[model samples]
Target chain A: EIVEAIAGALGEGPLKGRRILVTSGPTHEPIDPVRYIANRSSGAQGTAIGAALAALGAEVIFVTGPADVPPPEGVQVVRVESAREMEAAVQAALPVDAGVFAAAVADWRVAQASDRKLKKTREGLPVFELAENPDILAGVSQMGEGRPGLVVGFAAETDDVIPHATAKRARKGCDWIVANDVSPATGIMGGTENAVVLITGEGAESWPRMGKADVARALAARIAAELETS
Target chain B: EIVEAIAGALGEGPLKGRRILVTSGPTHEPIDPVRYIANRSSGAQGTAIGAALAALGAEVIFVTGPADVPPPEGVQVVRVESAREMEAAVQAALPVDAGVFAAAVADWRVAQASDRKLKKTREGLPVFELAENPDILAGVSQMGEGRPGLVVGFAAETDDVIPHATAKRARKGCDWIVANDVSPATGIMGGTENAVVLITGEGAESWPRMGKADVARALAARIAAELETS
Candidate 1:
């Protein structure tokens, strides 16, 4: 353990001298004091990606929401619960060589979140006025300075994976977009295996179904190679 | 590990000959094919409760939703994603010695969930027609023939914890209600520690702030005693 720590401190591997930022899990946007809006993100893929990067000797900053899986070992973990918090955490861990936006951030938050728990009354249902959350991927990709050289975003789709992801790559202005089908038929959501298509400025490349850990390793290697070339 | 397994099979402890069903985590309600509505429940307390019950030699069937922490060891785990599925799972595990409903089930689901991803358009925001979900706790508690001897429900409240929980006990027809304040100021939501007020027909008892594991063990012990007497 001591030897490994010393080696890590010396920064000695394929991704040595490089800093990468990764986001994982589902953010919880407050609805009331006890209630929140969230999604079904286990953070398995993101945790694997962070671990893979670290294994390659990259200094990884893992900004995570409430995740089922624990953050990978040997990475700086910053926990946040809301999209706004995740954005702030990402901003704080800026100036990286690459950034991976893997979190399933909620798109909207209650416009007027109640400080107290809303009681169920005889009156009609409580109306939740929602406001759009900030676009972290677009924000980072369009940054004028201190932006990562490679900005990768994820799009979990049920259909038209390629077309939608291609359009998303252009819309979000990210260098790469990892798209996957998450329909109930796929059993991808909260499942161990993943089948993704990598969309980039060059074109779209479909990868066969693989374990999330394998995907992470391959993606990390690709990131290293891209950084070396750029 | 082998010896522990043998002991578990023998059921030679306080809760021997008992079957306990526990529900944990937050149920996800689909809005669109790629989008969902969920609550902020990590299932930490419920996971610990399952572990504690198992430790007391109770055969535990854990019905879980998408949870942050992994399901406890020494229990049968049944995974579900939505409130409807959870209710079905619970009903299937009926005729148990006790039932613990710890899941933060979504109160509402979209009336018509989209078959495909809802695209962002220039027209207007997509309105989600919401419908109330079935009351799982009430349904289980009102099961006259097959209802467990002891039925416990959880109420995550921000204010008026005691009052609300006391009322909830009657409304749900449950034997006990474990209530806690999840206000941001309280730091209980997604946190490891808990301070709960256990409400019963007898009265409400406030417990000191403690680790979730400790609370689970205490609650499990209480359940064992109640079952033994009943």
Candidate 2:
């Protein structure tokens, strides 16, 4: 393991010269001074993927939201909270060999997010007007001049996983989509194990249920192989 | 410290035979299976307060949300997620001598929280219809019978701290209100040190800035004195 680590550090792996951008964790959209909207993505899978890619000697720029687990070792980590911040951070690390959109960014943000705490009035509950957040993956994937070689997006669905993921892959204009069922019964949102369907241009490929680290390794290997061919 | 621990275990302190309840952390109100609303309360202050109460020989019931800090030792712990769940757990641990409502419970929850994740469509953003959560503090404070000897409430305000907390205490019919400024600039929302204003029947008493543990010890001692006299 130590020798492998040294080899990775010395740029000896297949992906030695490749630069990869990985966005991980759940973005928190501020509602008020004290409260915010958040997702249950713990960034476990994304963190593992970053580690795996780094192990393969990729120059990894990890733009992450507020994740439960700490960022992995031997990677450049950029922390962000809101989806807007994550988008900005990702844009800054642009023109990479591959872009992995793993962070579960909030689809919308409170349009009138209060600077001060909102007081409960005698009338009724406060109304939240939401504005759509920017689609970071689509923005980068459709970039004509400075697009990455490969753009991978993640789909965390609760129903009709394969169809939903396949549709997402088409809509996002990404090379591949790693989709997983995050239903409460599945225990995969924050759990270590992952059962994912990898959707590509050819078709949807279902991978066996395995640990997040193993899934990351398999995905990283696939990415490396694809990059090697192209 | 060893002697204190032994003495507390033996119920040899001022709060011997007294049962106290402490609610700590921020309640998560789910928007969907994967999305939720959260605050910055780490439960550091409440954890310290529970420990201090336990050390003083009180039978402490620690009701906690998903806090960054774990519950203190020597207390019966109850874990919960949403405000409604926290309210239920707190109700189950009632009829105590004193109740410290320290948890940053959400005042409102999405009325139409869906089991399935809401998807974006041509219709645009989803409207979040909110319903007011049960006011646990007020429910306990204004109880005609079986009311605790003392019901203390906490106010985390971004502006007009004293006035806001004072109004909150009066509205909730609580005996005391511990108010603190949680503005981002203060760095007190999730930080270790706290500068609080204690409001009683008389008036507000501002305490000098101090560590959360010290603040907890002071508050716990005050509660002990109040319970002793009552």
Candidate 3:
């Protein structure tokens, strides 16, 4: 009874009953048995977000592609390789309070992923017939009933970040869009620091450059506050 | 002088005065400022090989892509992202006694990689014009007078391992081809264990399943012996 009183005073750190889903890393679209098409996402920011959310007492389900960094310790990690697998994993981890789609999902995959190694030939360049990958963010955001209350998607752009992110937020039907420039000059693609703009229905707010962990903590706090109000 | 004599007695592991170059990981070919094409190579085997050669007193120049595993200690690490960068790095590390091409270099790159982010829309699928990438292994093997004394390449095959590897060895003009089956059933791709077949001018010799480190040690020993005789 005394412990319960202290717990009540602590107030569960704001998100004790919340369940969050986060997708991280670069999805590999198979070209052949041994070859794949991927992106340059390291999953650093997403993993940090998962950690931050867990720290706030949210039960986080992390659906991750093959990432350079290991998944956060506290989150339930669902490892996947390709965009299709990641989509499946994300769908399976649904019915959460919030969803953060941070994964750099490949836009396309080989129409028929080769079952064997593709041999180099003297003929000419090989033409890869590609098929579009499913838009997981849109799917989750537009869910009829199981949609998360808060849906966040990422737009990694190099030019006109704000405008593009705003458009992406509307197109993906997500509640918020975190946009960041990953130009070579910015060194944000695989770097530790991030400079991002948070876009919502209200407006756009740009944050100064900070460590990935800091951005993640801020985002987690914002989510907590929003959930509290809702 | 006495310590030098003792070292001589211990044989210096046969690669004492040799310089070796190794390539590892999956090269990322950019599609846009933020998107790229890559593979699933973790560079575990290549890193282990670098470590093994270093342990044998060989000067190892380790050229790598954005790999999951950190480069091994006691070696010169050259970090790169795309196949072109990797090829340039390999060329810069020339005049080595041996060259090991183990990287899963992207076979093609976007003909004109966009300078900005590519927008997604309701219009249609975006078409990417891809150009063939330089065959690093074949180029190094057929380097004529500037080529290393011993050149090795890798053939990650799923079916018909021996025939395909032998053909690859002949086609690439490499002295040896280390072939492995990366079929999903094998659980070798990105896994800690490996089962490889060494194809030389003599014949093919398949090794049993073992840890990647053990495979590296065995390969290093074979390289040492070949260098010693040559």
Candidate 4:
């Protein structure tokens, strides 16, 4: 561990002298004191990406949510719960060489989260109103001056994978969008294997089904090349 | 493991020939194909209880939701996800000597969970409607015949602990109610230590703060005594 940290500090691999930010896992939006809304993101892919980046000698900053898989070693980890918290954490980790937005952040949260536990009462079901969360990817991608050299976003869709991811890339103004079909049949959402489409300005490139770590290594290599070229 | 199972099968302890049903963990109510509502139930207490009962030679049938803690050894484990499935599992495990209702089951679920991932559209946030879940404890307690010899329910309250728990005991028609404060201030919800109140027909008895496993053993001992006396 000490040797790895020394290597990272001294700048040692393909991504030497580079700094990258990777957000992994699922942001939980609180409903009240006890309950919350969550998505099934185990953070396996994001953790793998962080490790891969670190293996390539990049100084990695891992901003994570409450993930089942723990964060990788040799990276700065910043943990957050809600989307707002995650956005704040991302803002704090600025001016990196590249940014990878992999966290499945909740799009909405309970508008008025009660201070106490919401009781099941004679008043019937409570009114549940949602407020839109801040768009972390779009905000960073569109930033004028302090934006990273390459901003990458992720899209987990159930249908029309290529079309949705392509639209998302254009809409979010991101350099690349790593899209995957997380349909129940595919079992990719919480599974170890992923078949992803890399959407860029040129076009969508589909990768064959592979382990999450392999995909992470491939993505990390691309990121290193992109940073070196730019 | 084999020896323990053999002991349970051969009726080697105080709770010999006894059948106990225990439900643990938090039931997740789906919001969509990707999102779900969850609570901070680690299932520590219930898992401990199952172990304790099995130690006393009881044939333990453990019905559990998605718990952070895995089910203990030497018990029949029935894994469930939602409140409705838990209720059905409980019904199927009837005619037991005692029943421990420890799961933090969701009181309500989305009226119509979407098949596809909910998209953030221009129309604004989706209208979220909820439907009350089946009262599992109350239903089991009010059974005319084939009801367990002793029915136990649990109450997690923030304020007015005794009153809420007492009222719950009456409402659910359970023989005992284990009540605890789950306010964020008290780390008992997901923590190993617990300070709980045992409410019964006689009165409310407050137990000193202790490890969840200790509490389970004491409760299991009491259950053995109660069954023996009857």
Candidate 5:
């Protein structure tokens, strides 16, 4: 009781009783022991969100892929490797007030990963088969038993950020789409900073670029406020 | 020539000829020598965007306020403290292909900051005077000379994310707006992950929550793809 009082005194924690599920980082699609397909994601954003949510007093379940960054404190973290693993983890953590799909899951994965590292042959580079991964956000949004009240997805595009994001939202059937231009020049991959657009079925809102931590805090606060009304 | 060959061998850089401008972090409004008004911002999203843009081969100029995280590599980074300083820095680095306003500029600043640390007596608390700060994103978007081709803004809201974001886009006179809930309970303020909605004059797109780095990469890639066609 004393601890709770101290916490309440420190900040006006709005999320006193809420469950939030978040995912982060990149999933590696392995071709062999030495080679894999993956994106440059540091998981900084997801970890920060988890921390921010905890600070606001919500019970957080953070599902993450292999990331170079550490997970935030005060949150229950479930670590996974592949998209399949992440999806399962998310499903297990569901029936929450809100769900945020933050991981950079690979669109395609190797059909079969060799147990041993493959070496270059005299003929040429080896060919490998690929398969599409399940859209975790879509699956969660459409879940029959444990669907979250709010489901959000990420639309990382190279061109036509808004248009593509809009299309993705419809196709994926998610409630919100956070769009960004991820040209290599932006240095967003594997970096700490970010700039983004938040789009919903109703319209769009843009924010000035700022630190991920600040963004997370602002987002957490907004979620708490909305949850209160909803 | 050899160096060029090696670089080409690595990959076909998409943003080689492009220019990008990104703003990041929270602006501090000073109250006294020992106090200032600021928000919770780490500048992760903005820095990640700047890095992502640079990775795609665009020359990126990053203007940021104080941040807890480090800026991305291979980009020109200009650090500032207050909103006024951030605005000046952004203005000096204009005429880019794209502009992303991700900084959380203080809506108000101390009208008069005491030169020395405020001394407290046996009396009550001290009162502060505040004034509005310049809207850097709107300023750059409306700049007559050396204006960026595309202007993006971010709207952080605790309620009516879509409506507020849409209004912000129109009021700010920017091409796009990213809206997200930033209520304290969501853990979005100081966290690493983000979930946002993209708002534009046409419509809105919802996205899943993801790492800030992935969001940055996606945004950068989309920007590159657009530039390629445009």
Candidate 6:
């Protein structure tokens, strides 16, 4: 019943001719076959956004890391595991009308991946060398050949969400940044609920707490409206 | 494992001495025994934020409407069914350190609820007379008795998300506004993911897309950090 209402709403203007690209989930920095460095992200947000965009009549290309949930129907899903692979996949799905960077890409990756699991040494803890992973959003926003009309990034901070998010937008050269706090207790990482702020070049907009699906639908509709005016 | 990690991170903070008031979910304005005016809100975001605040060691008072999900443990929860009830709950819970208006409250309610379901007319659909609901966030923000130090509101708009949110913040007399587009296609009404912008007097901060759980954690951490510095 609700799906029919949504379908009726989608039969309109704005995103009809646009192609959108989205990235979701946490990128793993492999340490060994049995171990890796990754955050507790489930990619629910990205999948919802992709579904929302598709419902708005836009073609969606979703690049995702390993996630516990499945991608929504009707989206072009490209599965990847590591930051490197995710970056490659995003790059391949270029020339999109808009790009939403929803993936919790690891800031750093293991310098070298070991194919086999390492046995625990009797001697204390082992140190793993880490290297900075390329900022996929920045790379795509600033260097992609088919530059998207609008590039959106996320700033997940434990403190100073707005200040850090503002700086990140400028540093990444993206058109907008969505800012949120991710201190462990929130349960927002794998939980079903969310609270968020939308930041752009002009200013910031805060949303009421609701379901992630509601947020995604609202965002897709806003994007479609913006595209129409642009 | 995640809960332990969060507890360790929030060992001590400004929120340690603070009290927070939060509202979540949708208000059901009943028209008849079997029908009511409500939205598709699950109160996930508000509950997550409440849990986040509690995790940070703040005394949290949560006033929620009808919700499918449970509130975070350890926080004082006040359940309500109508917008009027939510407003009363918030007012009673006031004099807190901060207030987050994350609930997706109905804007209107039936002026008078029928004790029994009204039979459908053989000729046409029934019409309902609705009255404007009190703006819970705005009212609480402007209250003089034990008003919170920081008042935050959320604006869910389909078009001109930022602009409309900015106006809402000013009109509501809140310290910050979280804004997002909640059009039909986004599936944000009852889903698990979200994308949003935070708008404040200083400006706006956009964030990338991530899980709602991460968003809640980050927001809790930010509030704690901000309270400490201020």
User: What does candidate 2's lDDT look like per residue over A1-230, in tens digits?
Assistant: 46655767887787899999999999999999988999888999999999888988999999999998999899999999999999999999998999999999999999989999988888999999999999999999899998999999999999999999999888889999999999999999889899999999999999999999999989998999999999
Which docking class does model 4 fall in?
medium
Better of 1 and 3 by TM-score: 3
| lDDT per residue (tens digit) for residues A23-88 in model 4 | 999999989888998887899999999988898899899999999899998899999999999999
Per-model i-RMS: 2.1, 0.8, 1.7, 0.9, 27.2, 27.7
Stretches of model 6 off by over 4 angstroms after superposition: A1-13, B1-230
lDDT of 3 by residue, A1-230 (tens): 23422432343567788899999998888888767777778999999998888877788899999887999877789999889999899889988999999999988888998877777677977778888899899999989988999999999988888998998899889999999988899999889999999999999999999999999989998999999998
Better of 3 and 6 by DockQ: 3
lDDT of 1 by residue, B1-120 (tens): 344335656786689889999999998888776567777788999999998888888999999998878999989999998899998999899889999999998887778988887766
- The lDDT for every candidate, in the order shown, is 0.88, 0.93, 0.88, 0.92, 0.75, 0.76
Which regions of candidate 5 fall more than 4 Å away from where they truly are? A1-230, B1-12
Give Cα distance to truth, residue B6, candidate 5, Å: 11
Worst 10 residues of 5 chain B by lDDT: B1-10
Rank by TM-score (best first): 2, 4, 3, 1, 6, 5
Model 3 TM-score, all chains together: 0.91
Interface RMSD of 5: 27.2
Q: Rank the candidates by lDDT, best first.
A: 2, 4, 1, 3, 6, 5
Q: What is the lDDT of candidate 1?
A: 0.88
Docking class of 1: acceptable
Tell me the docking grade of candidate 2.
high
Q: Between candidates 2 and 6, which one is better according to lDDT?
A: 2
Q: Report the C-alpha lDDT of model 5 over B137-205, residue by residue, as the tens digit.
A: 889878887878788898777667898788778877888887777665677767888888877667998
Q: Which candidate number has the best DockQ?
A: 2
Count of clashing residue pairs in every prediction:
0, 0, 1, 0, 121, 55
lDDT of 2 by residue, B111-148 (tens): 98999998999988899999999999999999988899
